[model samples]
Target: MELYGQVLLIAMPIFLVAVLAEMWYGRWRGKDTYRTMDMISSMSSGVTNVTKDVLGLSISLLTYTWMVDHLAVFDIKATIWTYLIAFFVLDFQGYWVHRIAHQINFFWNKHAIHHSSEDFNLACALRQSISSFVNLFTFFLLPAAVLGVPAQVISIVAPLHLFAQFWYHTQHIDRMGFLEKILVTPSHHRVHHAINPEYLDRNHSQIFIFWDKLFGTFQEELRDVPPVYGITRPSNTWNPVKINFQHLWLLAKDAWRTQNTRDKFRIWFMPTGWRPADVADTYPVEKIDDLYGYVKYESKSSGALKVWSWIQFGITLLFLMYFFGHLGTIKVPGIFLYGGFIFLTVYAYTELMDHNPNALGWEILKNAFGSYLLFSTGDWFGLNHYFPQGLYLIAGYFVLSTLVTAWFVRKGITPDNFVTQATKSQSYSTLNTH
Candidate 1:
């Protein structure tokens, strides 16, 4: 956990910088693919996911170490062949796991968060899952286990593999001549994230492009079919935690509503968007079926609301970093307490972003809880030990945040959708690189 925290401390800044740079580049080129609240929602999702992973909030059905211990046929040294073979096996494992996640109703919830955003950008890449409490993909690494691969090799390679997927989740990058054919480029990933019928469930490979080619799921970004990104049934909310379990909740409701017991058991294993027959006819759900009629999920937001959202995002991020840096020093139940606080912070601000009228109340409660926790714990994760005025600074932030939120509520500040506003002002050509 400490090592992961350290990794976050180092990598978070770099990721933020990259997102900012991409934003600048897009603005300069006149494509501007990011919406402010959407970006905040995405980053908030990242925080929740990392906190879940850092706190070790997941269970594995079959341990990888056990697989390697019992299934090995030959002991292989860490040679070029070993590393090369490991990469291939991991890629293969990633492909199948990703395919399954998109194909099954029960598993889609674990991955739906990644497709929740309408706009595509580096910031949207941070939309990750936190409610996925099981690591069922470990069973896919059987080839590595059969080859006597060390758990250490798999551990080192796993993160590198995951991080490599981040860069390709952008609109700033155009097609690379030869690399497009060999790697999962930004163009390919845009298709993977699209809701367009031609692009749905296509290109499931992680690093190498051949997995999709071999498995028959690859689809090139065609000139005629410009991809419209996001899920068919929009989440329509900014809270990542809510978005994470939205699909599962729907499935659960369907399971209960169905008359047949067989339908209840079979609904989970059915195709990704499958619904029970009676429920489908009686309680029809809205679903997007055409790319030409795409309308993004959005809420009204004024300039002040956007600015306040950014401030809250910055505060939440700073406290998250503090929690990461001091993970070891904090004693029992402290880490869990920190995690709860982070979740509340994300939930409150996102509710505000979603334009919920009760958002002010949640924000007030969050600040009240924060103040009580600080007064009781005596510091912000032990910050008062080094900085004498740490408590005062945090107290000041809470006071200031509450005041700003209250001011917005009192002023009756109504907001307009950023994406709709931008689309009315700018035109994106289909022939353009983006």
Candidate 2:
């Protein structure tokens, strides 16, 4: 648990640096909308995803613990060389596990949950299925079992690899020059997340870009090659379970419907979204295009507003740094507090930026639930003992409900204005005609 806390400490600073870097890049590119609502929506989705991953990681950790104990009969020697070997071996195993997760239908169903997001941000990195632990653990444990590396060593190193991955999820940084050719950069990863036909199933590196480059899966992101983000089909809400399982359900139905066993097998092994028979692909390719679409055209920024926004963004960055930095240290009433803080930070950022008003209700509900947990519950609700992690998780439903509400509010904002403007324009045209 202390190690987990330490990982969070290390991660928070890296996250802050990434945020600052992204902000600077956004400003430099003149695309600094930085709406609070969009941030809230993205963050809300991120918190829910992170909770699921934590649960999954916990289960995986337990499984690895058991494996380590059983394998102790072999009396594995722990040395610096063993640790180094374990690290590379684990990463190599991760490469295949991640690759298969994208390719195999059973795995892709769970993996697709991460790719469902329309927005690319740091929080999205945590969005993965709890079931993914099964895939991740099965592969890495093989090394420990065969090579006789201690379970303690595997547990510590595995998370370090994961912690190293969070910053690669952001859209903030461009290419890192020479580093882009070797290590996976935000630029390299953005290509992986891209839904562009040219980019699908490309850039499958976990710790090193060399895997993709050597294997011919690498596609260098060009300024002319605008990225289209999100999956071909978008999951509409922050519901972790649905996000995780929906693709699996679809694949199962497809496999069941196919008469030939070969076709059934093919459906599972083929690239995601492949069907034995063509049914018009259900996912909105255009919507994905819109989400990742980059305009070569530039927007002019007012010098004063740009500077003011930067200052405000800087303040928010500091707040997030402190919030995440102290998160593991503080014992809260429920798991929801952590989730609420994440949701609030994102929503507050987006709201302040005027990107999405739909995310506010979810943020309110999350805050309400967190407050309830903090003040209303005594030890009866396991406040002092276990901290009611499940109760806090209930805010996820409210967050989804609020997003739905925001959709309506957004629709109302536009059409009403358009209708009034149309009416006024018609009236003026009539008078002019007379």
Candidate 3:
């Protein structure tokens, strides 16, 4: 975990720089693809995901080392060729996992957050899953294990393979002539992210384009149809934690509500968006039908609220950097405490972004928890040694955050405001369709 923290210290900056550069380039090109709330929500989702990862909060059902020991047919040496083979095998595994996530009902809960964004941009690429606690699909790497690939090699190559997918999640680049045929470019990913009928569930490959072609899931971008991004059921709120489990919550409700025992048990495995017929008829969910005519999810916010949200995101990011830097020093329970604070901070501000009436209460809870940490640790997690006045700044920040949130609540800042033209023009689109 500490080693991964160090790796992220290097990687986090590069990612932020790339996202900011994309925003700047888009503005200069007269095609900015970022909204302040959406971008902040995306980055907040990233923080939660990395925090989950850095703390080693998951368990693998099957270990790769065990597979290598028992299933090996041939011992392969660690060479350039071994790494190449591992890369291909990993991409092959990713393709199947991606396809299954879009095709299965229960599995889709962990993946819905990635497709929740209404606009496709580099920042949106940061949106990842935190609800996945079990590594149930590690068996997908059986081919690598059977060939005697080392566990250490898989660990090293897995991160690189994941990072390679980030560059293609952009809109600034057009189709690369030959690379389009060989690699998953921006154009290919746009189709994958789109909700359009022609594009839905099309490109499931991560790094290589050939997996889709070989598996017969490839769909070329058509000249006449512009891609419409987001899920068929829009996540109208900005809270990443809520978005992660929305589908699971629905499934649980359906399981309890259904009278048919068979339907109750089969709903989870049936398919994405499936529901029991009785439940579907009794409790219908709204889904986007007229894809071109729907109003994209937007909440009314003034300039001041937007600026304050950015400030909150920036401060939380700094807190994350500190936590990552001192993971070894912070140790077990303390590290968990720090992580809890990070999660609460995200939940607090994002609720405010949604204009939720209970946001003030959440902000109060966040500040109370942060104050307890500060008073108990007596130095904001050993920061006084590094900087003499750091604790004072932290204490002041909690107070200011509470006051600001209270002020917004007192002023009656609600999502029901008439400022957003889309909110005024149309009601929010329906939820579950299938």
Candidate 4:
């Protein structure tokens, strides 16, 4: 956990810089693809995912060590050749795992956050999954395990392989001539992210473009059928935690509502987005039909609110960095507590971003929890050791956050009213990237 957290301390900043650079490049090119709230939502999703990972809040059905121990036919040494082979096998493993997430009904919940953004950008690339509690696809590395690749080698290659995919998530880059055929370029990824009928589930490879080609899921970007991003059903709210489980919640409700036991049993593994026939007719979920004409999700945000949201996001990020940097010092339960606080910070601010009236309530709850931690632990998870007055400042921030949230709530601030006011004051136009 400490090792991963330390690595993230270096990686996260580079990612943020890349996202900011992409935003700047887009504006300069007159093709801005990022919305403020959307970017925050995406970043918040990333925070929750990383926090979950850093805290080791997952269970793998079969570990790589276990696989290699029993399945190896030949022992391989950790050389340059070993890493190259590991990278190749990891790419193949990523392809099938990614394809499964798109194909199966139950697994789609683990991946839906990635496709939730209507606008594609580097920030949206950060929208990974927190709902994937079980690592069910470890056996996909059978080839590597059989070749006696060390578990340490797989562990090292896995994160590097994941980070390598981050750059191609941008809309700023066009097709990369010959590289498009060899690697998953920005063009290939755009198709993978698009919800248009033509591009629904094509291009499932991570690094190698050949996997999709070999598997018959490859669809080239066409001139006429422009890519339309996001899922068929819009996740209207700005809360990433809520978005992570929205599909699973629907599935649970459907299972309970269905009369046939068989339907309940079959719904989970049937196919992605498949609902029982009776449930579909009785309780239909909203899905996009006119791909070009459907409205994108938006919430009313004044300049001040946007500024406050950024502050909240920035502070939450700082808290995460502190936790990551001090993992070994903070110890077990302390680290878990800090992780919980991080989750609450994200949930509270994102609720405000969604303009939910209950946001104030969540803020109060967050402040209350933070206060308890401060009083009971005698510091903000050992932050006082770094700065003498750090705890006091955190206390002040909590008090200020609660007050601001209450003021917003009492002023009748909601998506309905605030958006109207924002529109009359300033015209915010969606860029025509197509």
Best by TM-score: 4
Query: What C-alpha root-mean-square deviation, in Å, does candidate 2 show against the real structure?
Result: 10.1
Clashing residue pairs found in predicted model 4: none
Q: Model 3, 1-434: lDDT tens per residue?
A: 88889888889999999999999987897677777888899999999999999988889999898999999999888899899999999999999999999999999999999999987888888899999999899999999999999888998899999989999888778879999999999999989999999999999999999999999999998766778788998888888989999999999999999999998899999889999999999999879897777877776777899999999999999999999999999999999999999999999999988888788999999999999999986898889989979989999999999999999878886656622424423221211110
For residues 1-434, could you state the per-residue lDDT of candidate 1 as single tens digits? 88889999998898999998998888898778877888889999999999899999998999889999999998887877887788889999999999999999999999999999887889888899997888988989999999998887887778778888899988778789999889999999988998878889999999999889988999999876777778988887889989999999999999999998999999999999999999888888878875555456666678878998998999899999989999999856899888888888888888778776567888888899889889996877789788979999999988888788777766663444232322232222342245
Question: Which is the winner by lDDT between candidate 1 and candidate 2?
Answer: 1
**What is the descending TM-score order?**
4, 3, 1, 2
What would the per-residue lDDT of candidate 2 be over residues 92-168, giving only the tens digit for each residue?
Answer: 77777778878777778767867765556665675655445444446455656666777777777777777778778
Candidate 4 lDDT over residue span 1-434, tens digit each: 89999999999999999999989888898777888999999999999999999999999999999999999999989999999999999999999999999998899998999999988889998999999888999999999999999989999999999999999988677779899889999889989999888899999999999999999999988767677888898888889999999999999999999998999999999889999999999999999998766767778777888899999999999989999999999898888888888999999999988888889999999899889989887787777887879888999999999999898778787666643312222121233243
Which model is ahead, 2 or 4, in terms of lDDT? 4
Model-by-model lDDT, in order?
A: 0.85, 0.56, 0.89, 0.89
Better lDDT candidate (2, 3):
3
Task: List runs of model 3 lying over 4 Å from the truth.
Answer: 418-434
Give all TM-scores, in the order shown.
0.94, 0.62, 0.96, 0.96
**lDDT measured at residue 367 in model 4 versus the true structure, 0 to 100:** 92
Give the better candidate number (2 or 4) by TM-score.
Answer: 4
